[model samples]
Target: MKKVSKAIINFDDYVERKNTDSRKWSMAGMHEMATYVDDNSIPLWVADMDYKVPTIIIEKLKKRVEHGVFGYSIPSEEYYNSIKYWNKIRNNWEIEKEWIVSTPGVVVGLNFAIKAFTAIGDGIIIQNPVYPPFKSSILNNNRVIVDNSLIDKNGLYFIDFEDLEKKASNPKNKLMIICNPHNPIGKVWTKEDLEKIGEICFRNNVILISDEIHSDLILFGNKFTTIGILNENIINNSIICTSPSKTFNIAGIPVSNIIISNEKLRMEYLNEIIKSGLKPIPSLFGAIAVESCYTLDGLEWLEEVKRNLENNYIYLKDYLKENIPKITCGHLEGTYLAWLDFKKLGYSNQVLNEKLEKEAKLVIDPGEIFGEMGTGFIRLNFACHKKILIETLERLKIVFGK
Candidate 1:
C-alpha cells in the first residue's frame, strides 16, 4: 500500500519502441507479421509492456555492467534469497532455496518438465484458447494434447470440471499444464478452483505444471493462489513456472524460477536441464534484474502499472460499448492483455487480418493462433500509455464501426 515516487514512474509517458529490436514493436518474424504488418502501423500485439521497468533494476544492471567482467556467472545466495522473500511477501507462500531451479525462460522450463516427467507418447492435458506455447511444447515433445477446454459463459470463462475430471482420470494422461490468470481470457483461477483442480490431478496421480508467469498482474480485486500453497500431496505433485519478465517488463532478460518441492521430481528436472547442456546458473544480467525487482521497490512500480492497465481496460470496454458495439470485450481479471470477440464482424480470420492491417493499420494477435476456441477473438495488449491505448481504440472504432 506504499505509493511509488511519481517523479520516477510515469504511466502516461509514451516511449518510442520502433527500431529498438523489440519484437512487440517490430512485426518481422511474428506469426502474421509479413502478411499484415506495415512499417507505419502501431503494435498492440505480444505480452510485453510499453512502460519502463523500475529504476532499481536499471541501476543494479548499470552497476553490474561497470564491473566489466563478462565471464561465466552463477546465481548468488542473494538471488535465491530474493526469490524466497518475494514468494513469502507477495504470494503468502513459504519456499526454501533447495526447491528453486533457474531456467532461461518459462517456456524452456515447460519443455524440461515435459521431457523430465512424461514419456514421449504420454498424454499432457492443457486448457484450450490458452497460450499457444502450451500446445506447441506438448506436440513438439511428441506428447498427446488432452484439451480440457474452458467453458465460456457469456464473456467470462469457467473450467469444465466434469470434462477435466474425465481427462485427468485417463491413465495415459500423465501431466497437466495450467495457466493461472489464464491468457487471452484473463480469468484468475480462485483458491477453490485450484483446490478442485489439485484434488482431481492428485487423485489421478497426474503431475501438474502451473504456468504462473502472469500471477503478479492480478487486477480488479482478484487474488492469485500459487499452486504450491495447496495441500501437501498436491504441492508435492506440482511444478511452478514464474518469471519477472511479464510483471517487470523484462522479458528480454531470459530468466525464470521453476519451483519444484518434491526432491525426486526436482532431481529429474535438473537431469533434463543438464542433459540439454544448459548450465543451472542464470545469466549475469538476469541474476541482477531478478534480485533487484523482487523487492518492495519493484512491487510499488508494479502496483502503479496495474492501475494503468485497469484504467485502459475500463476505457477499452467503454469505448467499444459506446462506439463499436459489435465487438465484445471479455472481462480482464488479470494480465494486461484484453480479449475482444470479433465473431459478430462476420469475417474469416484472413479477412479480419486484412481489415485490421489495411484499414485499422494496427498489429494485434489473431485469436486462432491460441486455439480453435479463439477463432474470432483477438488479443490486444493494453499495457501502454493512455494515449497509445486511445489511439488503438480510435483505429478500431474507425475500422470496426462500419
Candidate 2:
C-alpha cells in the first residue's frame, strides 16, 4: 500500500466530479434536477459528500485493485475486528463477533428486519420528516404505516412521545425504525429521548430498528446514543443498522453491519437475507475500505472532515441569518445535511422547488419527499468545498433576498 499523507489538507480545495458518473453531478445521475434546471446548475441534493475519500482508505483499495483478478470474496477476520474496534473506541459499544451481520447497505438491512419481524397487513411505526426510505420500506412490503410525526417548534424538532406511545400501542404495529443524528433535520436524540422510545417499543412489543449510519458524522457537542444500549429488553428486541459508507463517503461501495444481540432475532434476519439469495460478504473493495477506515489514521482524517463540516455549517447558518433572515435553519446537531425552513417565504413545495432549481440555478432535496410535514423546507447537502457552500448561499439570495 502507498504511504498516507500526514499534511493537513485544505477542505476548500475543489475536485472536479463532472463526467465521473457522480449522482450529485451527472445528468443521468441527477435526472430529477436535470428536469428543472440546465446541466450547468449546482446540485446540493443527495446525502453523499463532494469530498474525496480518506487517503488511507483509497490507498488500501488501490492495493486490492492492483491484485490481478476480481472474484467472489468473503469478509476476513480483520473486517469484523475493524468494526468491533471502531464501535468500541468511537461509540463505546462492545459486541461479540456473533452479533454482527453483514448487509449490502443499511436500507437493505432495514427491509430484511421488516420482513423478518412483521407480516403483510401488520403496522410499522415511523417518525415522519425522516429518511424517505423508512416509509417506502414499510409500504413496499405491504405493511401499514403508522406515522408518529416529530413536532417542530420555531426551529427545533422534538419526538412527540405522546403520539409515539399512542401509535406503538396499536397491536398491529410490529416495528419502528429510528434514525439517530437524524437526516435532513439533524437532531441527535439524547439518552433520555432514546430510552423513552425504547420503553415505548418495549411496552407495545414493537420491534425497534435503529439506523445509526450517521452516528459518526455528529457535529457540534451532541452525542449519539444507540437504542440497543438503553436496556436488555431493548437490546434483545432491537436491530441496529450501522455503516462506514456514509461517514467515509463510500456509498458507492456497499457495506453495512446490522447488529442484533439476540440469537433468535439474528437467525431470523439472517434467514431472510439467505431467502432473498443475498450473500453475507460485501463487495471486496468495500470490505477493504471499511477495515482501513477504522484505523487511527482514518479517525484522524475524520476529525479533520468534521472540523471542516462544522466550519461550513457555521458559515452557511450565519450567512442566512445576516443576509436572508426570513429563511430559518435549525441547529445542525449532526450530519452534513442542513434542513432549512422556507415556510416563512410562503411558497408551496412545488413552487419552492421550482424557484430553487430555475431561479437560483441550484438543486436541493425537496423537503416534501421526506414527508408531508417537511413541506416548505429544503434539505441542502453541505459536505462540499466552503466556496461551493458560499456560492449556494449566493444563489439562495438571488431567489429569496430583497
Most accurate candidate by lDDT: 1
- lDDT measured at residue 52 in model 1 versus the true structure, 0 to 100: 93
TM-score of each: 0.97, 0.96
1-402 per-residue lDDT for model 2 (tens digits): 223555245675798888888877863455242466677588788888988877777777888889969888888888888888889888888988899898989999999999999999999988889998898899899998888989988889899999899889989899999999888799999999998899899889998999999999988878888875678987888999999988988988989999989999999999999999997667788789888888777788789899999999999999999999999888789999999999999997778888888889888888888989888888989998877888899989988998
Candidate 2, residue 310: the lDDT equals 95
- Number of residue pairs clashing in candidate 1, backbone atoms closer than 3 angstroms, sequence gap of 3 or more or interchain: 0
Q: What residue pairs clash in candidate 2, if any at all?
A: none
Over 1-402, each residue of candidate 1 has an lDDT whose tens digit, in order, gives: 222233258875678898899988887667743375777788888899999999888888888899998898888888998899889988999999999999999999999999999998999999989999998899999999999998888887899999999999999999999999899899899999999999999999999999999999999998899998999989999999999999999999999999999999999999999999998678999998898888888887888888888888999999999999999999889999999999998999988988888889888888999999999889999888888888888898888897
Least accurate 10 contiguous residues by lDDT in model 2: 1-10
| Local distance difference test, each candidate | 0.90, 0.86
* Clash pairs for candidate 1: none
The parts of candidate 2 lying over 4 Å away from their true place are: 1-8, 27-34
